[model samples]
Target: MRLFEPNTAALQALKGSNINITLDIRNQDLADLAASQDAVNSWFNTNVEPYLNDINFNFIAVGNEVIPGSLGGYVLPVMNYLQKILDDKNLHGIKVTTVLPGNALQSSYPPSSGAFTSEASSVMSGILSFLSAKGSPLMINVYPYFAYASDPKDVRLDYAQFTAKGAVVRDGSLSYYNLFDAMVDAFFAAMEKAGRGDVGVVVSESGWPSDGNGNFTTPKLAGTYNRNFVKHITSKVGTPKKPGAYIEGYIFAMFNENQKPSGVEQHWGLFYPNKQPVYPVF
Candidate 1:
């Protein structure tokens, strides 16, 4: 199992490959009081700043799964850490974000009624405020399979998998054939509630698994779900709610790793370990 590490040299190769990578660093101690100023200076100066060329850089993720309901206690401070790094480096163009799990929103179905968990709202309010002021977009990691895998009997396969399902039932309006758009609308609703409706929503992470580890749902379904998702994304047709804005998403992964955690996350890659294509990319 090869570990994924990012450094000055490694970052250059990654950017040269034209891969927009989002680095998750919530586990690191960037926000700690004991964190050295020199260390932070060295990091951005030595590791990040050297390679600011287009296509070589995308975003710097401050936290992962560190929302109020789960690990949010770390969010406020980590967010500050991100801000300081950006300011100290005098950097521009790179986005600083805290990649939040979808649960940060209260209800994410029907493309509306999006709210925060209450526990996360105040902190998220602060977060959205920061993103707005900083001209940075919020990052969200969503996976329909988790909701569907939890209750496959209730969730429709075609809609959840991005296949052409009869339009979904919403507010007495026959709308939404794919969950991607519906899911995005849910986030849009969340921002509206937060008074940040104008803020752009980007899928920090989203993907379907190629295997369910015998959890009842099959890998084939997950793979098909991923392929179709990319289709809708690349088609340039934005979400039903935000037709004016082109929905942007970074597919969960480029390649599968056998050493990755055993669960839905590990299998959420388009390619297998040996560089084999899981399915037709188109």
Candidate 2:
């Protein structure tokens, strides 16, 4: 039951009505781009595109949280490959993107003044320009957990809980309660600093751990965080930082990954391994 049923009758029977496939290859590097692309292209062409072409099920997020790695690493070359792939395949509007870590932005405190780190400036500048030209939104993985976990004393517990005050560090005149909005505001600042302030920023991955120790990632807390986080995001109340931008954010994994290496990471799921809801999401 834990295994993914590739094409059983049950899967095919409910495919159109039940689910969508988002191909996210975060672990792949640029050097392996061609081989990976070929494999993916084959899969999509033979399996997904034909039946699901008009169904809006095809999405390719080329990379994830990779902006702070070594050179010839995640952000730069992959960005190049993403653009080329879309152009070559004529897959316009397919929503190709590379999600960056929050660290990519230097200013994240007050939410009003976020800037890309100096280390990221060289390639980030090119990326911002390219995304603007291609009309692709900047993708970011904002984990307020890391901030809290890194310095729990400094970060407010309630803010990380997604149901209370986060922190209030005003920059250029703006107040913030939670790290989520501050994260988004930082992205806006990154854009402005990059000289491409008009490009849209999208949240690729976010979530409150269902459970952890000492920090608020506990199982009981996880359920509360996920449930309220969804409500808060979907409500469109705007982040305390930016009051009017329709900041698009996507929650993290849908399933609890038992085999996912560590206990902490494996615990971050809305469902248990067998495609069952861990809690009532609806």
Candidate 3:
């Protein structure tokens, strides 16, 4: 599971379970954490140190999808500081990274042609270098829904929902049957272009909303995509580019947030705020 912030209540709720967490330090906190080592230490002590023994903290996302923006610079510095804090405490199991949206890439189609935009390249180069050195994976928010939504005329719904019967796109040797793999491979290609092919990728967020977009964001489509996503990850049939590689992923949310910006953003959750599942995910 991925938490946007270190909510003490949510942390307490996850106390004894074996759930691997991808905890995030809100984007707004990046500048503060980057400027002061003391802040980073306090943040860690307050949010992580208390539950170290009970919760399985996997990755600390310093910032979410801040790249190609002003806050981009702070991401790596905060990650470096957080990594040192963990190192000093002899807690090396948790990795430090940042989440990036698909727009980070300039060319994603054809997968082989994937390359980061000039802006993202400048930032990701350093971030990718850090990841390579730390042996940490890059967290990418892969949303095929966006790709399909933007160009539904050309991008088929079956391809995005993982229900396509066969390969829908062929990029040289890579035959992409689903948009998910194509999107992921595009990131891989971009990383390779940045000279860090060794760095792995984790799908930090990916889900179709349960409502708010007519036929595109219906509960049925959302459930189908998620259910197939779980099966695809568990099957270990990695993308065509990296066959058999284990891909760790997480759904966008657990429950609907009415407070979120209206429309599809507020409906990515698998369950309603009332706790009833919008659709059977498992």
| Highest-scoring model, TM-score | 3
Worst 10 residues of 3 by lDDT: 257-266
TM-score of each: 0.84, 0.78, 0.97
CA RMSD, predictions in order:
3.5, 4.4, 1.4
The list of candidate 2 runs beyond 4 A from truth reads 1-15, 18-21, 34-59, 71-90, 165-167, 212-215, 259-266
Per-residue accuracy of model 2 over 1-282 as CA lDDT, tens digit each: 111213435335545563444445535444465345575555446444555543443345555655655632554555566556567768775665566788787776666567888877766787777778878777778777777777889887677767674346565556666667777877887788789887776676777566544445666666766676677678877665456656566677677767643544546778778888766655
Q: Which candidate model has the greater lDDT, 1 or 2?
A: 1
Writing each residue's lDDT as its tens digit, candidate 1 over 109-207 gives 666777777887877887888788887777777777776767778877676788765776463352788776777778778878998887776677777
Give the best candidate by lDDT: 3
Residue-wise C-alpha lDDT for candidate 3, range 135-248, written one tens digit per residue: 999999998898888899999999998999999999997799999999999999999989999999999999988777777788888999999999998899889999988789
Tell me the whole-model lDDT of each prediction, alpha carbons only. Answer: 0.67, 0.63, 0.91
lDDT of 1: 0.67
| Model 2: per-residue Cα lDDT at residue 225 | 61
* Model 3: per-residue Cα lDDT at residue 100: 92
Clashing pairs in 2: 166-177, 210-218, 210-222, 211-217, 211-218, 211-219, 212-217, 212-218
Q: Enumerate clash totals for all models, in the order shown.
A: 2, 8, 0
